[model samples]
Structures are given as structure tokens and as C-alpha cells.
Target: MALPDRYTGDDFYCDVAIPSAAQLDVVHDDELVLAYHHTRPFWATHLVVVPKRHIDSFTSVTECDEADVRQLFAVVQRLAREVTEREGAAAVLTNLGRYQDSKHLHVHVHSGPQRDHT
Candidate 1:
């Protein structure tokens, strides 16, 4: 039989750091939280926001998880504002299936210089 949609696996959670690997100041955190920017980023400013909980994916969100979801979005909005203030603009995104790398549910917040088509 196929594995259940919400199977708790080893790759569920992760430790997110800012500057990709370089130790920097922590902007925000909670009991289970990791938020930071990428050292080598696609955008001028790229940050990864994830819950300490090992959630499978967005599709796995349950009715009981409504509060968690709300909290996640709230954080995202707050972070977006911060990024906009710092970078002048921001974008939020999440991946699914093959696009997902950590296996844990996460949202990517990006902002910075706009790419120029040469």
C-alpha cells in the first residue's frame, strides 16, 4: 500500500539559517521557528521561512491546523513588510511535490533588485 499522505519522516524538520551559512543576527524566532536569508540568493534578498514542525506539505493542512496556518501567514505578512522596507519590494512563495526540497512545509520570501533583461 502507498504511504499515507501525512507520514512523519526523518526529513520533516530543519534548522534554517540566515546568510545561507554565515552566522548573522536573528531577526525573529519562536519555540519552533527558523527565518533567514540565503547567502547565495537568486534575488537581492532571499529568505526562507519555515515552521519547526515537520509538516509534509500544504495539501496536508488539516482543519485542526487552522491556527498554525493563520500564524504562518501572519508571520509571512510581517516578514513581507520588513523585506519591503529593507529591499523596497518582496515576494512570497511555496513549493509542492518535486519542487520541494526539505520535505518539510516552508515558504520562501524574496525581495531585492529586479532582474534586468539584457
Candidate 2:
């Protein structure tokens, strides 16, 4: 999956990805957030759960309201549980600072073997 140069360099989630999520394989969609399969998955069962609005990263979550944060986690929790049950195990994660590719508060719910990115 060849990503656009802008996707690698900028907040593609806020600028394009999230808005165009309809094209992705969505798992959950609500007023609070959107959960979908990763376009370029690093894990076999990778899914991304993100707040409907941007918040930069996990460390910058204070910018969002408590309810927004709660809702996002609630969704993440459910997805994690589902993945764990179906796949025998699951991992939930969020990156920060330089590790965060997308400048948006998002959680990843994934299971199974990790995939080779290169």
C-alpha cells in the first residue's frame, strides 16, 4: 500500500483520512468516533479507533472534554474486548510525540502476528 507523501508527513487524519473513512473498512461508527481497519496494517488484525475530532495525540488529550475522552475509550474498550475474544488475544495502543505518525488522538486495537512493514 503506497501512501501519499502528505500522509507520511502531516496530520492526514484531520486533513483527509477520517473525513474519507467511508472508503475504509469501518468496524464502528458513531457520533463520538470511528473505528476502522488500518489502510496499511502493521498487524494481521489491526483496527484503529479515533475520536471524531482531532486532539493531536494521546499526551494532548486534555484538549478534549472529559466526555469525549471517556467515549473514545469506551469504544476502544469494546473493540479490544471483541478482538481479544475472537483472536484469543489483543493489544491496545496509542503513540505519542515522534512515534505518532498521525497527529490525532487515536487508539489501535489489534491481534495476531505483527506484519512486516518493509
Candidate 3:
């Protein structure tokens, strides 16, 4: 899939990626959440799980985001389990503050050997 000339991660999930999820290798999709293979994978098996709605970041979650938060973690757990079962090991992770490249909340479910960085 062709990407923008500049791969800026800032809010890419909500602004760009989610809208084009159908074209991606989607793992899971529903009204509340979407999970798909990463466009630029860091591991042999790398998947991204995110809320369908716009939530700035985990730290920025508000009371109104309760349902979305629950759904997000539930999806992450399921995807992590699937990856672990298939690869014998898996990691579930989310970034924050400076670590978070994207402004939107997202979790990564990944396993297997690490790939070379681009």
C-alpha cells in the first residue's frame, strides 16, 4: 500500500489509517474497535488495536471514555492471546507522553523475532 511521502505518526490512526482500514490486512473490526496488521511492522507478527472513536491518549481518557476504554483493552487482550498462542509469546504495549508517537490511543499486540528498523 502506498503511504504519504512523510510518515508522520501524529494522530494518523484517527486522521488517516482507520478510514482506510478496509484496504489494510484487518484482523478485527466492529463498531467500537478496529485491529489490523501494522503498516510498518516491527516484529514478525505485529498488530494494532485501537478505539474507533477519537481518544487523544490513554492518560487523557475522560469519564465519557469508559466504554471505549473497556472495549479497547478487551480487544487488545484478545489479540495478544491470539498472538501468544500462535507464536508461543507475545507482548501488549501502549506508549504515552514522549513515547507515544501518535496522539491517539492505541495498543500493539506483537510476537516473534524483531524486524530490522526502517
RMSD of each: 8.4, 2.6, 1.7
Runs in model 3 with CA error above 4 Å? 1-5
Clashes of each: 0, 0, 0
lDDT at position 99, candidate 2: 90
Candidate 2 lDDT score relative to the true structure? 0.83
The model with the greatest TM-score is: 3
With a 3 Å backbone cut-off (N, CA, C), the pairs that clash in candidate 3 are none
lDDT of 2 by residue, 45-90 (tens): 9999888877887777674467778888999999999999899999
lDDT of 1 by residue, 8-108 (tens): 44353344342222363344566555666643456777777666566677888888767667777778889999988977888999999888766777787
Q: Can you tell me which runs of candidate 1 are displaced by over 4 Å? A: 1-12, 15-25, 113-118
Question: lDDT per prediction?
Answer: 0.66, 0.83, 0.88
Q: Model 2, which residues run further than 4 Å from truth?
A: 1-6
lDDT value, residue 95 of candidate 1: 90
**lDDT at 118, model 2:** 78
After the best TM-score superposition of candidate 1, give how far the Cα of residue 84 lies from its true spot, in angstroms: 1.4
Provide the TM-score for each candidate, comma-separated.
Answer: 0.69, 0.89, 0.91
Question: What TM-score does candidate 3 get on C-alpha atoms?
Answer: 0.91
